[model samples]
Target: MKKRGLAGEFVAHLFPRVVRGENLRLTYTFCLGGLALTVFLLLLVSGVLLLFYYQPTTAGAFSSILFLEEQVPGGKYLRSLHRMASHLFLILLFLHSLRVLLTGAYRPPRQLNWLIGFALLGLAIFDGYTGYLLPMDQLALWATQTGMELLGTIPGGTLVKDFLLPDGIGGSLSLLRFYALHIVVLPLAMGVLIVLHFYRIRRDKGILPYL
Candidate 1:
């Protein structure tokens, strides 16, 4: 009883790898990707929690925000966490891409990963934009209005705006569509791209310098 062999002894071997940082590659863009991932996790946790009580309809949206602000126990904390995580994601994504470009890491072999990262960045923006609409308050309304109007100026952007514009309201966007795309499509695409991103890293770049 209580004896150990190769399997149990493996626990002893585990500590040094982590301690010596052998457990994983540590590269500049990879580190930033990890940080962005952490932020995304925070956003997800806080967002789902908010979703429990959030109402996306025009009639209920502002009230839900007030409830979050005034009634919920940790509402402010959750709001702040979500907000901060969103900002951090933007920062981290930018830094990660910039790091790759500056280091020439995106050249050959890794070019597709960089392209995928760009797509993911756009998806992340859409995710944030969709989430922004959940609040459905004046600010979110005005923001979406501004966004769509600006988008309308792009080539074929008018068609895009028409596709997203609300049927019953003159000034509102489609809450259901945006929410579905955010909670479903964009994240799914990002997840796929993320798997490929990591795979490319391992296959092409291997590990970073340990020192």
Candidate 2:
């Protein structure tokens, strides 16, 4: 027998051969978590494609989007894929969370994974919000401004608002900040949380055996 290499060993360790048959059923966990991860990967790829033409600035943001839609080949579809994937990612995560709650998957050893999952959801939402402002259209501007104001109403929210929008929505600095968070900061944080979430699942012996 040929010995497995280090990478093969790691893969085997990550995904053991034995899994509960019930966990494989379509109705077991509904595969919501897996679907969410797939959509996230789609979003990441399409987002990178959009980044090629997207201008993160107060002056050129809207025009850059227009250029992407009208001038670049398949740019509209790429953006739409990213946008739709973002929505689907959130929806799948919400449903997955509901499934977890209903199935009591959050009990005991799995509680940490539950928190990590929710944190990923929150970051995903914030990532969407940040991307929403990148177009610099009137609607995006006003909508993001309204969101910032609402955020400010919460205690200690003003600090977050200030950090995110020091010069107010649509300002050069604010647009830059949003662009950075959307493309860089939030994605990195989400990646970290996703790794931890998966690790926890592996540590907890996977998916709670469908209750």
Q: Put down candidate 2 lDDT per residue, 46-125, tens digits, no spaces.
A: 88888889888778889999999999898888888888888998899889999899989899888988899989989999
Residue-by-residue lDDT tens digits, candidate 1, 8-116: 3333332223334454566555568768867877877787898888776667777888899899898988888888888889889889888878888888877887898
Backbone collisions counted per model = 0, 0
Listed in order, each prediction's TM-score against the native is 0.81, 0.89
Clashing pairs in 2: none
Query: Which residue ranges in model 1 land beyond 4 Å of their true spot?
Result: 1-30, 168-173, 208-211
Q: How displaced is residue 3 in candidate 1, in Å?
A: 33
Model 2 lDDT, residue 23, Cα? 62
Query: How does each model score on lDDT?
Result: 0.72, 0.83
Query: How does residue 12 of candidate 2 score in lDDT?
Result: 47
